[model samples]
Target: MSVQPMLKVERLTKTYAAAHGPLTVLKEVSFALAAGESLAIVGPSGSGKTTLLGLCAGLDQPSTGEVVLAGESLGRLGEDDRARVRNRHVGFVFQNFQLVPTLTALENVLVPLELRGEGGAAAEKDAGELLNRVGLGERFDHYPVQLSGGEQQRVALARAFINRPKILFCDEPTGNLDGDTAAAMANLIFGLNRERGTTLVLVTHDLALAGRCQRMLKLRSGAAIDGEPETLAGAARGR
Candidate 1:
């Protein structure tokens, strides 16, 4: 039997009420991602990459259409229920690292567990182990400001995986790091995804980063422009 997709986006669209009129940011976007698969959404500056990601991850409501994540229909859930679903099964890493400025690395990694109503020595130990896995063990006490850009991202990655989420959504995860740092961070992300059987869906303008995924979806003018990696690379370059 064929495996079911972990994420399914059907005829998704997002529109905002502009002063002039309704400005649609995403138009009939559709895709399916199987469990443990890695997919990248690549597009130019105004192609609605982030908008699509947010919609797929249930951070935003689609103007029309549906998103089913891990067999749960997101649109059918109330906001609180959707938030519960996300907290239970979704992990995220953002372009800016999004770590709490006041929280130390270990504390930040512990946020997910605490939110789930878990805490104490076991939780602290597990959080520390995750930081160690991300090569930040000794820096657990370091705040975001005390860490380098790459280090901050590493902490974000560790924090993201603390819950052992079924799927991880990343928005421009490597956008803030330098070339070498980005490459290293990519390795850590892909490595963890493989080891944990976590599905990955990321939005990135960096072709090299997108190329590493199993599949690519290119968006043009808020609609998917289905093509191979090279074609998407061309699209990113405006060629």
Candidate 2:
């Protein structure tokens, strides 16, 4: 039997009302991601890549269409219920790291598990393991302010994986890193996906990073366009 998609988006659309009237950011976008698959959405700034990610992760509601994550329809859930679904099955890595300034790296990594009522020594142990995996083992006691951009991002990555989420969504995860560091981070992400069979949805401007994904969808004028084979090849070659 064929496996079902971990995420399914049908005719998704989003609109914003500005002084100029209405602005449509996403236009009937549709796609499906199979379990353990990785896909990248590539687009220029303001092209709605981030908007699409937000809608898919239920962080924002679409003006039309439906988003089903792990078989749960986000359109049917209220805001609170949508949040619950996200906490249960979705993990996010943002471009800015989004670590708590007051918390130490280890504590930041532990926050998600704690929110899920998975606290105590066991959770700490797991958090530590995740931090170590991200090469931040020695910086566990350091606060976000004390770490470099790359280090803080690693901490965020660790936190995102703390729950072993079925689907992980990342937006410009390596945007702030240098080229070498970005490559390392990409390797780590791919390694985790391979090891845990987690589905990945990444929004990126980096052609090299996008190339590593199994599929690439380019966004233009609030819609996804199929990337040509040569485009994929060029991305794979880090052009």
Best by lDDT: 1
Q: What is the per-residue lDDT of model 2 for residues 138-170, given as tens digits with 9 covering 90 to 100?
A: 998999999988888889989999999999999
Against the true structure, what is each candidate's TM-score?
0.93, 0.94
Model 1, C-alpha of 189: deviation from truth (Å)? 0.4
**Model 2 ranges off by over 4 Å:** 227-239
Model 1 bad stretches (over 4 Å): 227-239
How much is the lDDT of residue 194 in candidate 1?
88
Which run of 10 residues does model 2 get worst, by summed lDDT?
227-236
User: How well is each residue in 1-239 modelled by candidate 1, as lDDT tens digits?
Assistant: 98878999999989999999999989998888888878889889999999989988889999999999989999999999889989989999999999999999999999998999987899999889988998887998999999999999999999899999999999999999999999889889988998899999989998878877777889999988853322233422321
Q: What TM-score does candidate 1 get on C-alpha atoms?
A: 0.93
User: What lDDT does candidate 2 reach at residue 136?
Assistant: 90
Give candidate 1's root-mean-square deviation (CA, Å): 4.0
Pairs in clash, predicted candidate 1: none
